[model samples]
Structures are given as structure tokens and as C-alpha cells.
Target chain A: MSGHSTYEPKTGFERWLDTRLPIIRFMNDTALDFPTPKNLNYWWTFGGILALMLGIQIVTGIVLAMHYVPHVDYAFNSVERIRRDVNYGWLIQFMHANGASMFFLAVYVHIFRNLYYGSYKAPREVLWILGCVIYLLMIITAFMGYVLPWGQMSFHGAVVITNLIGALPVVGKSITTWLWGGFAVDDPTLNRFFSLHYLMPFVIAGVVILHIWALHVPGNNNPKGVDVKSKADTVPFHPYYTVKDGFAICVFLLMYATFVFYMPDVLGDAINYVKANPLVTPQHIVPEWYLLPFYAILRAVPNKLMGVILMFAAIAVLFILPWLDTSKVRSMRYRPTARLYLGIFFLACLVLGFCGANPPDQPILGHEPSGFMLLDADINSIVWLSRIGALYYFAYFLLVMPILGLTETPLPVPEGISEPVLSHPAAAPTGAAAAPEKRG
Target chain B: MSKMLRKGLALAALGLALIGGQAMAASEADEPRAPSGGWNFDGPFGKFDMAQLQRGYKVYREVCSACHAMDLMYFRNLGQKGGPFYDPKYPNPNDNPYVKSLAKDIQVKDIDNDTGDPVQRPATPADKFPAPFPNEPAARASNGGALPPDLSVISKAREGGPSYIYSLVGLGFNAPVPAGLTVPAGKYFNPYFVGDVSSAWHGKGPAPKGGFISMPPPLAPGKVTFDDKTPSTVQQQAKDVAAFLAWAAEPKQEERKAFGLGAMIYLFLLTVIVYFSYRRIWRNVSH
Candidate 1:
């Protein structure tokens, strides 16, 4: 059955086109002949789920764009109409909104999985870098989409962010004006944001294709640190992985359906219901949850330009992680000391994200102010937490892996495929004869 | 193999616990009740007794409906208690039949045509109160540069919200006279007024100051009687209308509160199940 030829080219033109494109052959080879490690487990499935979410977002976004009006006066009302009057418009809007949160949720898992398994090491560096690019594009797309509603949060957010650009030295004001297409964030700004928000998702879809292409070259990393050395150590991607990935996707969809149908606004902001008003401001400003950690870093620094640059650099730093960590082992399983520290580093990142979402606390009383000193005991607890987390974030790549590579002792290595005790246990003799060496 | 499964189970358990904790934290903060003057609503807050709301509903049904619209609120909402409309369940019920009879004349648009124009008919239970003008230009032309805004969602749209509405309604008392502006005993100046402020007639407006408000104080003491002996002051009426407007803006208030409660419970149970499932699935595995 596997060897049978299913296709027959009737015409010379069709055969010629097939040779040039080779689309079906490419899919079969990468998705079939690709040798995936047997011990990948569930965590590795998140990359495929993230890709599915990206597709969901692009399709829903295009449909929404067809009905959404971009003018400031009409944008708010248009959303209301979509909610109340259009055919199943509420479901579409809710899916697009919540799908964004889910996409981020999956990507976070994907990144953490990479970190735990050292998927960024060696030849897989390009895959990790492309993933970072996709992450950046996702951020831009979500931010632009947030402003298209022209609600109170959208209007104020646009103002706050556009003003940040004006903090630049020479042509700052002009740049902001050009961005707004006016003196302030008004009708023109909303229109342009609508256009770009509609455009960026498709751009992200393109980047995701590149991300998958990069992943295919090195294939996937698995739970075991050992590389595939024999047939038993690997499996073809066709029946095995195709079935596994398909099952994972179904389970993910069930979880997604719960949010889409039951609690659509679970991740939405309340203030967004109010139409745009230039004179008013929301009591607090926050970006979406996926942006929280970087936003925390941006707020951690006192200086505006420094904060902006540091926040960006924090993300860009991930691209260079392959070169930064000098460890020879590919997975944390082989590096016991580094594994514990990396787990703590991951926890710190989660904590930073939570802090960023909540309101920043005031500094405790009776403490001296510290100036630009990286470590200051007198600063607010939140500031300290952010600072420490930021330090660990850099240290994980800059110090821990390299130091462990030289000093730490690894566990006993497993022998070749057929030699492990469990794989090749000596058979017991018949009941009485099996006890021959018991006295010794 | 068992060790890998155990690690995966542990991670899933942790994620579920975190989600459950967040849901519990959020539901505690989302309880719904009457607004009790916090944030922007503090200081010299006006009263909005049931009787006053009844009167405001009267004024809305009668005088305002002549030229203004409230396309956001439903007629059935009038039956709800503690809102701008008189609650039928109030201890001393006002003459609702009289009010309802008067409101019967008002025509509201019930459906939209293929061209997206509202098809007008007598107001129904589910229909939002109709606007006085067909569109923005028509509203502006009729109201002398005062384009009456749609009252639907107005309470949520403004910064100070109901307070702003109340304050704006009661503006123009003890207002200072501008240079070249004429002084009248009862007229109020509106900033949005088309004519020059210098030549405009100044009067005792609803509150203290007025720049360009067009409409005069429509609610005077004794204009409408309250069954509960509450004073029918304009301030009281303003408060009632503001409260009513808040409800109009978020008609799903009750549903939101209920859903929040259910979600909290569901998350808690799911968390517990996930914890045990993790234990069960990983019992034989070493991490």
C-alpha cells in the first residue's frame, strides 16, 4: 500500500509543472521521511498548535476586516453593530480576540519547551531565531489590532505609544505626526491602524512559514539528550508523528472551544467598550498579557530611552542564546545543576509577568533612593523583583550554562541500543535451575 | 519513559493550579451592586430616590422625546427596580399607568431596511427608545447647533459618566457674565451655542456655570409628584437619569456577575481534578 503510485500525469504540461513545483513530494518527504526522536512527549506538540492558531487568526481577521469601518466616528459603532446585528458576528469577533491570547499561550509553552530541552543549541539556532522573529511579528499584530476598535483604551494606548516615539531627539515630533497622519490620534490614525492591523496577520502567516521551514531542516529535539544513532532511536514522520500531532491538535481545539463559546471576554479589557474620548484617560494603562514581561522591563528602568532600548534588547537577546551558552550537552537532563537554576529562571519570568499586569507598588517608607545601582535594597519590592528577574534572565545564558559546562559532573552515559539492562535482560532458567548462584 | 510522563504531568498540574488561582482572585473583585459614590462620584453627590427617577422617566417620555432620542435603553428596562424608570415593586407605587399611557404615543424604529435605514413603528418591549432626529445633520439643524447625542451607552462613554451628566444638566446657576454677553434672569449660556457668547443671554442655569448649553431646566419642583414624598428637585432627577443611563449602558450586568461566579467554581474543581490526575498518571514514574 505504501509503495503504490497514486498519481498519474496524463499530459506533458502537468508532468512538467509537477517537477517544477514538487509541492506534494516536498510535503511527503519532510512530513514522512523526517526522523523524529521517539521521546518527544507532549511539550513538543505546542509548536504545531501555535501554527494552527496563527492560521485561525488570519482567516478570522480577514473576514472581520471586510465588515469593520476604520473612521473614528464609525469604528466604535461598527463594532457594536457587529456584536448586535451581523450574522454570527459575535462569535467571529470573540474567536479572533481570544484566539490571540491562545496563540500567545501556545508560543510561551513552545519557548519554555525549547529552553528545557536546549532546543536552541547547535544546528537548531536558525530555527530558534526564526521563532523569535515570529514572536516579534505577533506582538506588532496584536498591538495594531488593539487600536482598530477605537475604544477608550485603544485611543489612549495609541496616544501613549505614539508619544513614546516623540521622546527621540531630533525629528521626534515629525515622526509622531507622520505616524498619526495628524496633530493627534484621531480619525486618520484609526484608519491607518485598521489598514495595518488587517495587513500584519498575513505578514505573520508568511513568517510562520519560514519558521516551520527552519524547523524542518534540523527536525525536532526530544526528551532524551541522546541523538539518534540507530533505527530504533528514530521514527519516520508519516504514520507515527502524523497521528500524534493530529491527536494533540484535537485536544487543543476542545480547550479553545470552551473559551470561544462560554467565556469569550475572559481576557478582554472593560474600558474598551467606551468609545474614544481624547480628553479622558483610563486610570491605569496596560498592554496585553503576552507583553507583560517586556513591559515590566521597560518600566523597571527610570530613563525613557534606556528603558525602551533595554526592553527591546531583552527580546532580541534570545536570538544570540545559541552562541552565549557554551554547554556541550543539548538537553538540561544531562546538566543537573544548570537544570535547577534554569527552572528558577523560568519561574522568575512568570513572576515578572504577573507583576507587570498588576499596578506597580509604591516604594516602602524610610529607604534611601538608589541611583542607577543595579542592586538596591531600598527600592520598591516590585522594582527589586523585576531587577532580579532581569539579572537572572541574562545570567542563564551568560554565566550558568558556560560555568556548568566546565565544572559539573554528568550522570553515567547509556551504552549502545541493545546493551541497556531493561532492553536486554537475561532470561531466567526453569524454576529450580534459576537458583544456582544464590548462595554467593 | 515513565520519568518523562511524570515531568509532563507536573507541568500540566502547575499550569492548572495557576489558572484556578487567577479565576478565584478575579471573581472576588467583580461583584455587582449599586454605585456608592467612589472615585469620580464623591463630594456633593445628588440624591436619586425612586420618586425622582419616576419623574425623570416622565420628563424623558414627554418633553425630551419631542426632539431627542435614547436609542440604547429598552422599555421593559423601565420595569426593573432601582433604575431611572419607576420600579413597579416600589412600596408606594407612582401612577405608572398614566406615564405608560403618555409614552404610548412615542414611535421608535424597530428594524432596519436593506439600505440600512431604520424602519419606524410603535415602540415594542424589546426596542430601544427611538431618537428624535433621524441623523446627525438633522439633529443639529433642529436643535440650533445642539446635536443631541444618542443616550444609549452615554453613561459609559463619558469620563465622569453619570456624574458628568448630572453636573451638565444642573449647570448655569450663579454663572459669571462674560464681556458683551447680555444678562437675562432665567436663560443659560451654552458653549456649543452657535451665536457669539458675548451677545448671548445669560440666565440661572441648572448648576452654577454655563458656556453653551441650549435646553433650559425642564424639571422644576412640583412639576411631577413623588409618591414617597421625595423632593422633586432637578438634582434628584439628574441623579436618577444618570443611574438609569448606567444600567442602559450595561444591560448584561446581572449575567456578567453570575458567569463570573460560575467560572470561579468551575476553575477550582478543574484545578483539583488536574492535581489528582497528575498524581494518578505519574504514580509509577520517577522525576
Candidate 2:
């Protein structure tokens, strides 16, 4: 023990770190060292999996940048060259492209994991807020990166998004001009977007570091919502979690690799293959899969500026999730009412994503199509779904969380650590009883 | 218990045999075919004839370097000689030398000279193919308003590779008008011009049934010698050059296929490992 203590650094960089960044040490002691509830199922592994995905994206993205050209004229062709010519360029490009989808997949799971566990509660509020911020950044980065290819969709997307700024009251035109770097979305726009897309990932990496830091502050919230009381409740993260996370990462990679190699462009838009043509517009302009919910929300509002603002607010509201839920319990396993509503809310989000990806439908509320007819029926459907999704998206935060917090939660108190673990068969009855208790 | 274990082992072996048999069958089915000399102009064509492609590569190396730059392509990729696809083993030994020679030949601007005037001898491989013109005005003056686009992504940028090149080169005179417009004395146009049709062309005389293109057909009728001793014609040379351009545009074809195959194998192995590992870990535990 004495010898082990002596191994600790006494001076220089270690000493400096000890003083300035006590948070890491503190985290290691309190949250990491703090015993975790033993009943955390596979769902809890998603957060670790999500972090691994972020790492994959960053690594693959860096390698892709080595071969990718940023020029509008050459960007799409360069991508083709990478697919066709560069040594193992196809693998790198496919990995990056498919990795985007995988990252979203993991994030969706991670978010759902948080919802299921109520990990957004109390002291972990900052962690949850940081996660929301990271999600928004991810959306922005993906969107901007999509435009770098200068494909038909990319051009239209830029036009649509930049034009959204023109919907503002006073300095709209100036702002649009400033954003475009010209009167229209042209070469300068592509160049600047390329620069920013490259830069934003680094920013996201920094934020992720912060997000993980915040997570470590509270450690992990377990399924039971019961705080750990002793050493018996927890295990060291090095071997146990290291192995678990590693296995999860490997499994995730296998799935990712399958898609990357076999069906790389499954998630991509076909229109993106065609070069950007300002004169001839594509039949459809869909945002990436990740942005579907927000895209739906953007269409939900009638007013342009208001819709944009609402869309921004929808994401911004997620940052305040820590404060919104007044629930004493951390995990939805104990909070039965929160569980059901959260599940429904999750389903609603999925529906919104699906609808957003689909072509918008004509609004049933109106008698005739608008005179302008610039906006399509698909936009209308997206708007309605957006409105509903946005409403639900907010309701889950503002109304549902607070309401569920006040309501009674049907919970089963677990026996001591040595009690026989309940298998799925044994847990069935408990699950059945827990059904009606899902109030939110 | 021992008998039961042996039975389980036998079953596992049988499953492995089945899988192995299937994979063998698949591999046999996917074998690549040697290039055929039949040059079909219509429908899909194999990327290009490998022999003609190699000759075209040589031509590009020797002659085209004087005026044109394939900035999009790498030197070593030409060695994907067996097919239109690239092979990593065939490294371009001339890459460094070619680049150095090019650099020595041309004078790119340093901070001292921002205008970027070429300094001395002609450009070497290291130098960016010196622009035909220093600026937009110079380029227009030299190329008759049409800037020679970078050859790097040209194969991808254009719709059909060989036919486009062939048509672009085979310009001479205009065909008889379809009763619409009064014809000029010397000017000619191609009805099948897929690209900006309005763009002007420059050929010496009346073209074949198709409209005359501005670019005078560069091939001297029977220039490129084919490997199978196929008729060495202008059309053949055009096909060869187009194939070379296509290969240059996308050199990773073979590597992608190889990696894709490898990844599938790895995934199959991974799946098996994970399945066994999961079974091992959960063997004694009751569900």
C-alpha cells in the first residue's frame, strides 16, 4: 500500500492537474467509485456505445478529409474519385457516410436510454443539457457537411435554409447576403460551408469532452433510481466497463461495417448524385434523416420566421430538460407513469422522423391550395406533423415531465443484493402490474 | 454426456462445411472475365479495353502532358494494368521523378511574385499542369471562350465516357438540314450534341450524318494499335483514350471490391465469434 501511494506524482504536470482539474479526480472518487445499482440492463450500454460512435465519426472524418476536395466544381467528382480511385478511399468514404447514420442510431438509443432511466434529472441536469447541445451541433455539422458535395439537394437545401433567414423582419436581406457571401448560394457559399463543416467537428469534439465530464460528475444513473450505499453495489470501471463498452463497440462496428460495405448509400438521397443545377430543381428537397423531426417542426408553423424560431427553440428547450422534470425519482423503472408517456413521446418522434423523410401532403384544414403555391403539399404535411411533434416535443418537456413529477409512481422496491435475480419470466408479472401506472 | 458433446461437435462441423461450401460456390461464380476485343458503341460497355487503355495511358504520359493536366489522377494508378481497376502492388516508380521534373520545368509563384508567371523551361510532373492561360481572359483568348476543364473529374462530369470523347473528336462537316434552317457556307453543327448545344464548334468541312463538332477529330484514322490486332481506327483510339480517362477518374475499383469482400468475411467471422462467446457466457445461466 505504501509503495502504491508513492507511485502518485508529487510535482510538475500532475501537481498542476491536481489543482486546476480536481473535477476529474472528484468524479473518479464520487461517481465512478460510487456503487452502481446491479440491475442495469443492456439499454444502459447505449451511452457508452454512443461515445464510441462519436470517436468513429471523428476518426473516419479526418481520414476522408485527406482525399476530399472542397471546391463546388470538383467536390462531387472528388467524392467519386475517392470511391473509384483512391487507395481504400471507398472504405473511408463509406465509413464516413454510413457512420453518420450509425451515430444518429446510437444517439437515438442514448436519448431513449436517458428517457427510460430519467437520467436527465437533478444533479445530472448539466450532463443532459450538454448532451442536447451536442445533438444540436451534430445536426448542424451533418447539414453543413451534406452541402459540401454541391449536389442537387445540397444546393436546394442551402437555398431553402439561407432563404429562411430572409423571412426575418428587418435585416433579413442583409443577413441572407452575409450568409450566402453573394446574392445567391454560389461557389463562395460552398467554400465557406466546407471550412465551417471541417471546423465544427473539432468544436463538437470539445463539447463532447465537456459532455462526458458532466456525465462523470454524476456518474451513471442505474435502473432502480436507488443511490449506491456501499462497495458491494459497484465494480471498477477499468475491467468491467472497459470490457462491456469494448464488446458493445465491436458489435456496433460490425453493424456499421455491414452497412458501409454492403449498402453504403441506403440512407443517402438519390438526387444528391446529380450536380447542383440552379435552373432545374429536383422534385423533392429532404433534409438528412437526423433532421427530419426538426424539419417537420419547421414546416409546422405558418409564419416563416416564427417556424425557424420555433425550430431553434425546439432544440433549445432540450437544454432546459434538467430543470423541467420535477420528479424525485431518476429512473423510469421506478416511475411507471413517466415510462409509458416517455415511450409514446419517443414513438411520436419516430413518426415525425418518418413523416419528415416522406413527401409532404396537402393540408386538410384549408379549402384551396395557397395562391403562391411555392410551398408544396408535402411541406404542408410536414408543417402539421412538425406542429404536432413540436407540441408533443415541448409537452414532454414542459407539461408531461412536471405532471409526471407530481403524480404517484408505481414502483417495486428491490430486495438486497443477495436476493435471487428476477429473470424475464419472473419479471413478466411485475411488468404487467406496472402497465397502468404509466401516466405521463 | 460425452456422447451428447460429440453429437454437438458433429453438428457444428456439418454447419461449418455447409457455410464453406456456399462461400466456395459464390467465389467461383464471381470470377472476372478477360477483356473481349469486340467494340460495341451502343449499350453499356466494360470501362475500356485494357490493352487500348494501356496504350492511351502511354500517349497521355508522352504527348498530352505537353498541354493537358490530369490533375485528378495519380501516376501509380496506371499500373492497374490487368484490368480497368487499380492494383496497389503496381506502384508508379516515375511518380517522384515525374513530379520533380515537372516542378523543375515550370515556375510557380512564390510570395515575391504573386502573378504566377512561368519562370524557365516547360513544366515538369511536379508542377501543376501550367494553366493554358494565366487568367480567365488569357484562357478565353487561347481556347476560343471554352476553358479546357480539368481532366480530373471529367469522366464523371460527362454523361457517357467513350461516345462523348468519340463524338467530340470526330467533327468535320454539317449534315443536310432537316428542312428547318438556312445553312452557313462553312459552319457545321451536330444534332446529337447532348451538352450545351448552343456552344460553337470548329471543323474544316461538312461532317457525317451527325452534326460537325468544333474539335477536329484528333486521331489520324488508324492511330491506336489494339492488342487483339483489331482494326486500328480513329473510333478505336477515341475508345482507348476514353477508357484511360475513365480509369484515371476512378482508380479504386478493384480495391473497393477487394475490401468489400474482405469486410464480408470479417463480419461472418465476427458474427460467429460473438455467437459462440454469447453462448459460452450464458451456457450455465438459466434464462
CAPRI-style class, candidate 2:
incorrect
Chain A TM-scores, per candidate, are 0.85, 0.83
lDDT of 1 by residue, A1-440 (tens): 12233355567876786788856556666667666666568888787798789889988888788788899878887776665446667667777988999999999999888887778887788888988888888888788888888877788777766776775679878999999999998888888888888788777778778877777776676665445566566666655665566566666765676676555555767677767878656655667788888866765554556656777788888889888766656666655777898888888788778756643332323232333333322354445666677777767767876676666655332333223312322322222221111110
Error of 2 at A47 (Å): 2.7
| Tens digits of lDDT, candidate 2, A1-440 | 00111123356886678777765555555334433445556677777787777777778778778888887778877777777656677788878888888888888888888877778876678888888888888888888888877878888888877787886789999999998899999888888888888888889889888886776656667766555555566555544555455566667777787677655656787567666878766545678888888776765555567777877888888788877777766667666677778888988888778756643343434533233432322323333555577788888888998777776545543333333225334335555433223321
Question: Tens digits of per-residue lDDT for model 1 on B29-88?
Answer: 111222345323222222344454565566556555667676645565565433455445
lDDT of each: 0.62, 0.60
Q: How many backbone overlaps does candidate 1 show?
A: 15
On the 0 to 100 scale, the lDDT of residue B250 in model 1 is 49
Chain A of candidate 2 gets a TM-score of 0.83
Q: Please tell me the TM-score of chain A for candidate 1.
A: 0.85
Tell me the TM-score of each prediction against the true structure.
0.63, 0.62
Please name the candidate that would achieve the greatest lDDT relative to the true structure. Answer: 1
